[model samples]
Target: MRVRQMAAPLGAIVEDLDVRAVDASTAKELNRLFCQHHVLVFPKQQLTPDEQIAFAEHWGELIPFPYGSLPGYPNIIELRNRGKARDVNQHWHSDMTYDPTPPKLTMLYALEAPAIGGETAFANQILAYQELSAGMKKLVGSLVATHSAKDLARLYGQDPDQASEAEHPVVRTHDESGEKALYVCRAFTRQFQDWSRQESKALLDYLYEHCVRPEYQARHQWQAGDLVMWDNRCLLHYAVHDHGEDPRLIHRLQVQGTSPV
Candidate 1:
């Protein structure tokens, strides 16, 4: 397999490989590329739900999404447009951060996509953390943030009051690579631990905007045969919903991860 850089900050496109048949050596190389690049796109591939699960298993155990999953596949989440106004994925985030042990990686295989305009964008938080001013880095290093599932809970018709919440360090170190990354995001992170939202808003908003700056981001235009996966341990992603009412279907799965340090 050959790997080509997708963007300067992060992402790589793997060529000359078939997802349905990854061998042990290829799996080992893929894992190294994944930890180094944070995102990988495998184009022109057909993967059934079972095949996708098999590919994901090379990395770690699968985690069932909180809301629900595909009828027969308990670990695969089916993604589609829910209208622009109510789209839960439009905002930037790492998957399921409100859980004490959020997923370490998320994979998506497009079964159907619009002829135009359904894209996903990713931000490299490792680069975001590296570019912060020394003082800012020192401050964030000493901080912890609280993440909540209230917005998603409400969107799914569940009681927001019953949503799960968890606290994670503002700067998390990757368990495998030992690299530091900014871990807070606009979607779930409510406030710095021990600080009121009112007091934390300015700084939090600054970081929310800072982490996704164009220089640190890459975008992927979806196609029916694309299999894309990203490391949730060091990145934030946004699903663009500009395809109007056109159909877009994707099967998604997550790899279990440890609590962020």
Candidate 2:
């Protein structure tokens, strides 16, 4: 298969590969490519729900979306933002970190996109982790942080205190590559468990600020038929809400994963 870099830093487009019939070897190679590239974009590709699930299975088992089931397929998650509806992924996050096994890889197939701006931004958490000061790394490495949907719930007008939260390693080793990554994000990471409220806020604010440095990021401008797959273990993503009157619709399939090993 032919691969072309989208830009200098992060994304790549794989050409001449059939999405429907990816073989085991190809899938393994793709997984390696995904780790190296962080984001893989397939342009002008169309997939049925079954096809999407099947394609996702080439990498690993399909994990259902966090909120609920899709309209037609009870397993798939509809990632759509209607003009009247509230956008779900407005902040930077890794999917479903509150769960025991968060999604390893997330695959999003775009059905619709605005003519103008609705680009997705990805930050390389591995790079973010690697670049931390020696003292900062040691400080964070010694602590475990709580990741929750509570803050996001509050932002969406839901009760923040009622949402689920979990303590995870601040610097987690990726199961596949054994590379360390900063596993914190603004949306889900509530606090460092060992710290007091004031201390937690201060440390978390510092981490969130460091995790999003421009040098570690790449922005993806969606095409209507683009299928984007990303390694959730090593990346944090943000969806830009630039679409005004028009709607943006995406269907996402996540791969089942274990806790960071």
Candidate 3:
């Protein structure tokens, strides 16, 4: 497998690695690479739903999206917002934090794209955690936080009545490498547990700001057949909406994982 760095800190374009069909050995190596790199981008991989799901299964169990399936295929999550709808991932977030066991890995396959923009940006949460002071790390290590869709909906100008929250460790250790990451994001992380409302807000806001520093991020521009897989546990991502008239469509598959911590 050939891996090319897209940006200095986070992104990589993995070429020559065949995702269409893989041997057991290659699949194991790919999983290891994914853990180290955080984000792996396939420049031009055209895969059907079955192919995508099959490839995802090589690493872990597939997690069905909460909102049902794609239009034609009810199994895949349609990550498109064209014409009237437009792309909705304008902010940084880890997917499905509302669930007790949020998806550990999220794979997105590009179907269509515009000439410019719609690039996805990823931040290295592990790096974010590593950059903290020893004192701050000790303080955060003893804490836990609540992640909720209700908090996210409110940020998106939607009501929070339908959303639910899950408690996750403030500092999560990666299943494979045992690397600790700051398990927080702007989307679902409401506040630190054991802190008052005011204290929670201040602490969460500080952590969120620190995790998204520019030096720890990489942005990937899309190609029609590109397939990207990211570790949702140790990274945060944002989809940019730079395309105006043009449209972009993608299919997403998620991998099941234990709750944070």
Candidate 4:
């Protein structure tokens, strides 16, 4: 397997790696590489649902989708568009932050690549946090933010006020690398733990913008047989939906993770 950093801000691509039957030593190296580079892209890894699940298990137990899941694979979800619905994944955010434990990492296997534009962008939150002003860092270091599933529920056609929520520190330390990262996202994060929405809006909006600066981001265009994975602990992703009327399908899996520290 060959690995090299991508042109973007914080991801690397690994070529000639087979995901179907990854060996122990190869898996160990992948883990270390994942810690070093928050996102890893493996082109031409066309894994089936079962094969994808097997590969995902090498890291940890998979996180099941609460609302719906794949027919036979409950832990893996399908993201397919035959051309109708508006793009729901346009924001720069972390996945499932409303859950207490959220997810350790997420992997996406591109099955049907788009003809034009279905590129996904990633932002390095560790770098975002490190670049913050000293006063801002000190201010957020001791604060916690509330993430709600209801905001996401509305987008998926569920009840808007479902009210499932979790509180996590604004500045969270990575479990694997021990680095601090900004964890608040514009999608699910509503307000700081003890602050009202009106009081927290300005700062939260500022952080949401700061975390996704172009300098800290990398973009990946879809490929028919690509497998992309990223650490949810230190990266925020933006899924662009500019490919109208084009078919796009990807199978995604998430691994269960610990609560933020």
Against the true structure, candidate 3 has what lDDT?
0.83
Poorly placed runs, candidate 4 (over 4 Å): none
Worst 10 residues of 1 by lDDT: 80-89
Rank list by TM-score: 1, 4, 2, 3
RMSD of each: 1.0, 2.0, 2.3, 1.2
Q: Please report, in order, the local distance difference test score of every candidate based on alpha carbons.
A: 0.93, 0.82, 0.83, 0.88
Error of 3 at 181 (Å): 0.7
Give a tens-digit lDDT track for model 4, residues 1-261. Answer: 899998656888999888887988889999999999999899988677999889888999998977788898889889986674664367778988989999989999999988889899899999999999999999999999998888667777898677579999999999989999999998788899889899899899889888988899989998999999999999999888888779889999899999999
> Which pairs clash (backbone N, Cα, C closer than 3 Å) in model 2?
none
Clashing pairs in 3: none
**118-199 per-residue lDDT for model 2 (tens digits):** 8899888988999999999999888888888765676557777677778888899988788899998777787788688689
For residues 1-261, what per-residue lDDT tens digits would candidate 3 score against the true structure? 797777777666789866887878888888877888889888778798889988888878887875558776555888665653332356688888778999999999999977888788999989999999999999999998887787556655777787777888889999888999988877777777878878998888888899999999988888899999999889999887777668888899899988777
Which parts of model 3 are misplaced by more than 4 Å? 83-88, 151-159
- Top TM-score: which candidate number? 1
Give the Å error, residue 10, model 3: 2.0
Give the best candidate by lDDT. 1
